[model samples]
Target: MDVQEKCRSWTADHLRDSGDCYYQAVTRTSGGTEVEFRGTWVIMAASHDYLGLSADPRVREAAVAAVRRFGTSLGGSRAACGSLDLHEELEGRLARFLGHEAAAVLPSGFQANLMLAPLLADGSYVFSDSSNHASLNEVIRLGDAKERTFLHGDLTHLEELLASVGEDSGKLILTDGIFSVDGDLCNLPDMMKLADSCGAHVVVDSSHDLGVLGPNGAGASDHFGLRPLLVTSALSKSLASVGGVIAGPADIIYYLRFHARTSLFTAAASPANVAAALAALDILQSEPERRVRVLDLAEQLHNGLRALGYDTGSSVTPIVPVLIRGRERCLRMWRELCRAGVFTTPMTYPAVRAGREVLRVTLTAAHTDEQLMRVLDAFEAVGRNEAEHPR
Candidate 1:
């Protein structure tokens, strides 16, 4: 067979055993924090709805209003007639929220990285974290810059690499502010210090931390009290929308606006997504309690998992991973959790390690304390039962 067919054939047996659940769809949410999956109410632990603003009535109304006014498509790219008033407003609001001089809203956070990295990569040596998101890695490879990847969150190693490079023209350090899989926060302040010492630029992809970090949800930079060279985030997560933002100096945004091919070629975000993002920002600002609740519940979940002898490696955020190691055991636990009316996703091989597979669970503000307890109970019961079989 062809390459596509060959790949499919290679993984068909493995996928058939446990990967099918990923394709299953939820008809609707049974509760704000639970979904109706396969005719059962499964508590949601696999989504990025940290603040639960995606289902907020105000966010929904804002989206509806935009749709009513703008229809659907916005014609051409931002460089063309696709540039709308909503886009500019959203960009400005995001900049102010992040305490940045300016911002450029993109179609998606992925596209933002794909475009921005190339612009900054010219005449530069790149220092990237090994565990950063795929988008950052893609942009680095696409660019002409020479790149070095240090161990995840290893600033000493990063500094060593930077020191060896000896001040390149466009020295850039790329990292995810909040790692998606493990939910570990990168030390941006220390990274900034290293960048400063080495005369390098820092890029913080805070896609997973925006609208859920900082004292006021300003983002990871604000949380660390340091202003990096560049900050980027996806609106889809806590922003409850479907776009991305690149916040930094206005001059940089101006440069990217003119040079970033992705922005120049791709159309602007839909009016509904823009409006929803704006609404989500408002909700995030007005309701700081949501962030508190999410973190609290996450801590509780983390603790419970640990007490049950599940190895959750270095996570302090809402995303909790129960490192189950073996693929078979991981799939078995996932299946058991699903059967027990708990919805979760398993992270394996490419996402993590083959021998360090995990059941990745994310908590949101929408999850009630009672629901959290029930989820823990499910794990407790399932673990107890699975121990006897050990399959």
Candidate 2:
């Protein structure tokens, strides 16, 4: 069959057996947050706006001024006619912010990984962490490098894999600085030591860790004092924008600027996005206390959950996972929480192992103590109800 027919068949099959999924599209008003689905005001605890900079007046003004000056679209790839002053400014600012020699901007974090992996060609081996994000997995699959999976947070496994690679082969060790699902940090110091011993270059994806971890939010590397060969992150998360960046040696960034398919073929980030990211970076740099607040909120939530007898997996950061035994219970709990005006994402199946379904609670600096208490109360009520119902 043709492409349209095949897509229809696949969609039919998938939807036929799909379970109910809940989502709320929120509309912001001057007074409070409103949910389009429920048509009522609701508190938000689901967004990744870690520092609440997304709606900051200064950030919004910067974005607006950029749009007014440069218009909305780049209309071509960066290498062609899309390269603009804003793009260069953002890249330069990001490189300086992260203390990297240079940086290249990509359309998204997924594309950043996808492009970076393939840059390491033949005679190379990619030693990847087991708990890395799916984008990194896709990057490895597309690359020609021989792949080895090391157990998550296990430096011993990583060392063994590095040793297995051929002596002359160039090795790249890739890991998430902060795991997305569990919010646990990678053992960067140990990983760096192992990579150094094996003469392997390290690339860390600090998608979740940036703007929340590290001193002044420089990310996990700054937090641990282990300088990697490269670092990549998304502006969509903590920066509250719509692009990705790869920061490393100046020569490597120049190579990717010219050759990385994602950057060469895709249109440059809009001026507004670049401006917002720049403003966010300035805010992050100026207000070091925001990072501290995020850590404090994470500690408070983790402690509260543990005290209430919830099984929070080994998380020490803003991402907290409350383990639910089964998929059905997980979905039910999620629905119950939503019904009670608590918004959260349910992670299961391919995102995690089948039996490891969880309610992923992300904390942000914008959230107040009262809001967190409400979230804790909602969890307690849901857990109690689930226990009583046994389904």
Candidate 3:
């Protein structure tokens, strides 16, 4: 079949099994641990609210107060005088929280990667991880710089590729702090040491790890005590806010503020959203127990699921993927689990390897022991159900 026909056929096939799959919105929320899907309240094991700050009363109040004061949107780009005090405050707090010299908040994490490409790609050769998110993938493909892809988390492949390029050539390496699909960390300490040996610079997308990793929830870099040249993260995930930020040297951030076209021209982030992120930072600083709690939940689930005979891959983070290995099997499990009132994401081909599909379960700090038990029971029941009813 032609490309369009193939895509249409794929969509048709996906729709046949996906009941309330993609594009289904939550009608109600409770404690940030459960969401209403298809008019049924289901435990949210697929959400990214790691610290549960998204539903915190303090965060809600802060966002509400900002809306009352600033009236919803900023309505223009930061460069067009749409910038608010909250923007500056969040940037400062993120820089301090992540131990960076400076930081600039962008409209979204996708745009943050785009902004960095122009600044860093001008004189560099990009060496990217094969499993890096689509944002970083697009940057490498579209930027002016030449690029190469190393095997996912394979330092040997990276070293070989780096050796092929000139030592004097400016090098930019991009990777995820915690890979969303596999939930494995990047080995930043080793990566940084290798980069140093070759005089290359590294940039990390800490969207999944920031506020959920490290000594004080400082992210992967802090977890390893290595400072990359630049680091980026999305506030929407852990911070329960809507925006992204890049923390790096003051000079680079200054250049991006003036030159990054997306951040320069796109409407500034909403004041309330920025305030919510600020409150999230406060919680990260004060309630370190929240971080511990979430990690403990992740470990419990990871261990429990493995003990029950499901393959969890190599996850060490809140993002755990239960590898069911077939599209039909994965979807059937997802459908059964949802019916059992446990919602999870079934990741099939294109999101994961063709034969390594998974049911992605993302745990949050707000998830209670009772809820966790319920989810585990539901999974066991669903897996048994899947085996009884074949595709």
Candidate 4:
């Protein structure tokens, strides 16, 4: 078949079988409180700006200064010409922030995983959590490494899998420090203990945990007092900037800097992103109360949803999913919430499994108690209406 015909056929089949798999874009203002699409303002509850620093004035100032000094792009890969003083500074600050011996910054978190997976190489087996973020799964596929998946957050299953793998094999146990969809934390201390017993290295993707978990926002490892062999995180979520970082032993950082193809091919993070992340790190280090406030808000929001008769499913982080049973019902709820001035995303099918559609709500530190109460009120109203109408 011709390329156009093949593309058309695939599209037709996909639309016929999965017509409900679509997303709507709602333009957001700089403040992040107001979202406008098709000329209507809506309150945003779907963002990953956990610390609410995306539009913070200090962060903006840092970005602006960096842009003036360095322009917009890094222009080349780190191996070539992209490395800058800001890059080294950010890496150093992040390493210190996470209590790691060294850290390396990449263009994105996806690349960090893509690089690390293959760097571990042929004899290694990857033990990944079933509920890990898609990027890690993609890394496992691209690396062409032997992999086993344990049940989501089931430490017993993880231990069993680790026990089955031989001790001589280099095993890398990979999991999200905080599972993105459910906002539930991994049982890190237990997982670390199991890995230690089995002689496996632990790699945690703390994209959702950094700037939100642990004392002083050191992340899940610190929260549980169990250090992993390595930690990877995205700056986009909590740090409210762009770029990714991998933190571990100095040797691992050195190896990835030289051998990881993704790092070798892609341009390093831009100066502005580097600067903004550095500023965010400074804020996180000096004022740890921000982390406490964000966690407190998350707890309050989760409790509020539960009190209103929503099934939030064991979430202990900033992300809370309200189970809505059917795809249509979930979308309807999302639309209703949006119209009622609270914007959230409807997650269904591949993002989750079939029969587990939900309205995913992410809480941020910027949201006030009044705003949270308003969100709860909207959910309560929708819940009552949906119950009465049975749709």
The candidate scoring highest on TM-score is 1
Give the TM-scores of the predictions, in the order they appear.
0.96, 0.94, 0.96, 0.94
Model 4: per-residue Cα lDDT over 244-308, one tens digit each: 99999999899888888888989889999999988888887787777888889888989999999
Clashes of 4: 0
1-391, model 3: which lDDT tens digit per residue? 8999999998887778774566778899999999998899999998898999888999999999999999888789998979888899989989988889999998788888887767556667899999998889887766878888999999999999999988798988899999989999998888988999998889999999998998988899988988899999988888998889999999999988897787888999888889999998999889999999999999999998988888899998899989997777787778789889998888887888899898999889999999999999998887776677756
Q: 39-62 in candidate 2: lDDT tens per residue?
A: 654556566777778877888899
Native RMSD of candidate 3 (Å): 1.9
lDDT of 4: 0.85
Candidates' C-alpha lDDT:
0.86, 0.82, 0.88, 0.85
- Residue-pair clashes per candidate, as listed? 0, 0, 0, 0
Would you give me the overall lDDT of model 3?
A: 0.88
Q: What are the root-mean-square deviations of the candidates from the true structure over C-alphas?
A: 1.5, 2.1, 1.9, 2.1
Ranking by lDDT: 3, 1, 4, 2
| Alpha-carbon shift of residue 83 in model 4 (angstroms) | 0.6
lDDT of 1 by residue, 298-385 (tens): 8999999899877788999988988887887887888899899788998777778679789999879988888899899999998899
Worst 10 residues of 2 by lDDT: 28-37
Q: Which 10-residue window of candidate 3 scores lowest in summed lDDT?
A: 115-124
